[model samples]
Target: MKRHLTHLSKTILQNSSSKTLPLSRCLSTQEAIERRHHLFTLEKKRQVESVGRIEKIEVRYKGVPKDCTLVMNKDISSPYDCARHLSEWHADSNALALIDGAVHWDMHRPLSENCTLEFQSYSSTEPQAVNKAFWRTCSFLLGAVAARAFKEDVTVKLHSFPGPDIRSGSFIYDVELSLPAWSPAPRELITLSAELVRLCRRGAPLERLEVSEELALEMFVDNSHKAKQIPSIARTNGKVTLYRVEKHVDISKGPLVCHAAQVGRAAVAAVHRIIGSAAGEPEQLYRLQGVALPAGVMLNHFAFNILVERAKKLNPARSPFSPFGEDGVRNMAATA
Candidate 1:
């Protein structure tokens, strides 16, 4: 009685005619960047417009220039704005904002309420948090520069970066590129380094934003991997943290350095192919790596070359290919 199941006919395909319409012209890497930047700008403007009324809050400055309470706009003024009022030195050197003796905030992230504020530099007494932030920023910039370095034909899909490890001697960015088996020449690496240098020279302030999971998904629609990760990232707090510099934007668990200029000397040292996966499928993942020093740090070319050579060795960061290790590669919120 159960033997009546029949397989569906194999082709219907024989009768169905297919037409290939001209493929929609794909966006160039630079165009894609501009598009994303436009979206980010519009959303940022909307958030600012959502603040119906201006309200003032006190931001008590600590450390150099003595402690004092300054009136700041609630949800409007940021640590950066406060710094600008004090001195140019405060505005430029500060990397992270220490608030109320506890929370470490992004300098560009707005002050939500009355809080005690102290700025952290690369040379602060307890600089662990600031160091992590600078490392993370370098990794983020690596993605931005590398993505822009490729030609229009090569697709660049940025994956997650493991949390910053300055001890490892390099910051990392994992990306999937269309050039599956391509090996980079020395000239290519030099070009990438030059791109990083140009970007840092722009001195763009790194803007931090928190948005809903839905919006995060919208922002990263072009990136399937990031879209997949956003749900898990937003699960904990129902929001995803994003950082933007110039026309490039990306997600991160971050208190990124105040500005790109803070990365004074840098080199795009190596890019290692990450092959093999739990699925055992051929993957196009590449780990773009670099070494960097803060603005005030001094190193001669010979000494810096030593650091570059050290960074050329494959970094020991967690591979995005490993889905089910200590933390799932897709569960970026955990590792990042």
Candidate 2:
């Protein structure tokens, strides 16, 4: 099975005449991911360097190995850093950092003030927020895989994913591909799923960074779809939140669970074509759907298959293409 998947991934990007390439694909999907990733790195480094005089804050940690107060760097230290001071298990599990028992903050996002902190994991008593984060991370990962899954001549632009609806049974990504019409074969879907699992196993943190609108626009200049959304997303705060995994970067208003390795028992169940509501220039975007359980959740194969079947149905999340230019275009209402 491993050998077959390896071969399948190699050939997944080969062009098929039946699925002819679009004229718009000047840069390959991998090229675009790399370009955006570079800008994200530079912006992140700049932000880190600009946090000049190091300030200290007291973080009242409220769980595991007894509650204790930790002195950490302000605007420079993240909950992830606190976890490191606690235990490797906390660090590796990628716990969701809950601030003051009220707000759920990303494990990696810097804490701005002196606040009480607690960690939440996939197996927490109330895992709703953690579950949502996991789902969003999966959706983001799906977009990364989908982009490079296509051939160089093919234009694969990520449209958007709605906020997480676990009851809807799958995480989704709406992508506008250059192909006029194409259907994924069973093997192709398996290949996509395999690629996602492979990525998760390799271990990558879903790092978060908030960039100015100008920088966000510069980062996504290669992709017209994201460029259109940045103006609206940055309208409120003038800052766009971005998440990066390895070399892939995308937009999100995120508190994503710490890492990708938490995603386990995954499947790319189906792909359906969705019609765009943007009048005159209707888009035929493909809605890619899949289901994933957090790592360590044990389910028999039969039950997992049932979930796979359910995810094959069309997701009911509001179409990202629905009537644009309206006030308040949201940051990709993602996995969560």
Candidate 3:
């Protein structure tokens, strides 16, 4: 049975490679995504194996149901595991984890040492941090959907997304497409929105991994913009944080939501093109804007439409290519 399963996996991989070969000539977006995902998986597996010995840590979970101390594996167990110890409600609704009441950590990231843990959901009394994480995840998912929405002929290079600004009324991703003078119609926008919804329905867990600068550069080498930003990102922590949703992987300084399903009501509000250059930047950049509410937040259609309308307007986030002062540039690039 083991041999048969291995053979089956190989067969499937070979078939997929053969099917995508024709489009692989130009390094299609799908192929690039597959390559990056494969590299990420290999690197993640290597890192996991390198942890030959695992130690136990005390996790003082302070949240609903009750506050208790749970002993968990150090560098192996995550807050999600602690959530599972509580209840399904926690395992599902928790968006981000607060460590020692200070660091906002990703639910899936392993605990490095003994610390207090608190889960944050969208409905928390102060949901600002959770909201920001949700918005950032939306921006990241928007880039994934946009990268796959177009035909294999179109070259889509994802630039960078600004830091999440919930007050800005939308999440944004700036992409550069090879197509000239192409604008999406209303129907096309709806289709894109549906695709995003489909992705959310899959309920894929957002896996977080911290990788070395070398691995980060290699993973994003296909996209020049991300490759450029990785060095700047690594300069701070000496490591780059990556998040994987199903087969899609991207770079972000993140404590993103636990899963895609946390994004319940979403719409591809608008795609605005930014042309012209004050500096030596690309003349064509497309800003993909979208609005999303948390899974349990039930707003009326009219109210949701208002949000959609507001999101359709241009967001005032910094451009990826704009030359700002050192602090401004660092802030803009840190969020990407």
Candidate 4:
């Protein structure tokens, strides 16, 4: 069974490689999405099998509505698991988890040791971290939508996105498209928005995985744009952060919302073609912009309209590049 599984995995990887190359303008959006979904499933299976053993970890949890110590499986007791011990509300609304009250942990990433845990929701008094995580998650999801939004012929190469920026009134993703010198019409932008809504409507929980830089590169090498960004992303820790939604893995330092259902009334408000950075840089990258309200935030259309209008402008957090070659757009909404 092990050998057969290995052979099956290798076959899928090879098939994915062959089908994805020779970028064309002939593949439909549905076909592209199907391909992406298949590759994601194969990769996720490989990742799960990589974790060979099980162990136990003690979690000393502290936070609102109540506090308790949880005995959980090591590398299996995610913050989300701890939340399940609290309440449905905690499991759903909480956007970020603070371990030892300082280390910002992804809600779905496993806990490895005994430590105090705190869950932060968007409405917390000091919600800076939660907001940032929400915003970064927004940017991350923007990438996911963009990946599936373009027709198969239009190779959507996700380069990198700046960190979350709420003050900018939106999250941003700078993507490299194989199609050159093209601008999105209003109708096209709306279609992308619909795609975002469709994806969010599925309510997939975001899962986090920490992999060595080598594994990270391996996972993303198929996407030229992301492959280009991996080295710079790993320069600081030599490890890569990956977040999953229905098996779609991508790079990000995340404390994303517990589930996609939390995003309500999403709109892909605009796309701006960014040009002329330097050689070896993506000659043209599109900044995809959007605004999202949380599920419980009952905003009147008037207020929501204002947010939509504000999000249409070019977000001024930081340009997507810096001295370290890392994307500079910091979290307008990520945990501090």
Work out the TM-score per prediction. 0.89, 0.89, 0.90, 0.81
Candidate 1 lowest-lDDT run of ten: 11-20
Off by over 4 Å in 4: 1-53, 320-336
For residues 189-274, write the lDDT of model 4, one tens digit per residue: 77778878877889899876656767666555556556666676667788766777764567777767788887878888888877
Best-fitting candidate, measured by lDDT? 3
Backbone collisions counted per model? 0, 2, 0, 12
Question: Listing every candidate in turn, what is its Cα RMSD in Å to the true structure after a full C-alpha superposition?
Answer: 11.2, 5.2, 6.7, 7.8
Taking the tens digit of each residue's C-alpha lDDT, what string does model 2 give over 1-336?
221123324543323321233223444665566667767778888988998999999999998789999999999899999999999899888558999999999898998789999999987899888988888888989988887666555677886777887899999998887767667778878888888888888779889999899988877766777877788787788988899988788888877888888888899999998876665333688899999988889999999999999999999877766654332135444222
Model 3 scores worst on lDDT over the 10 consecutive residues at 1-10
Q: Over 4 Å off in model 1, which ranges?
A: 1-26, 280-282, 323-327
Assess the local accuracy of residue 89 in candidate 4 as a C-alpha lDDT between 0 and 100.
83
- Give the 10-residue window scoring lowest on summed lDDT in candidate 4: 1-10
Model 3, total clashes: 0
Candidate 1 C-alpha error for residue 241, in Å: 0.9
Indicate the residue-level lDDT of 210 in model 2.
Answer: 90
TM-score-wise, the better of 1 and 3 is 3
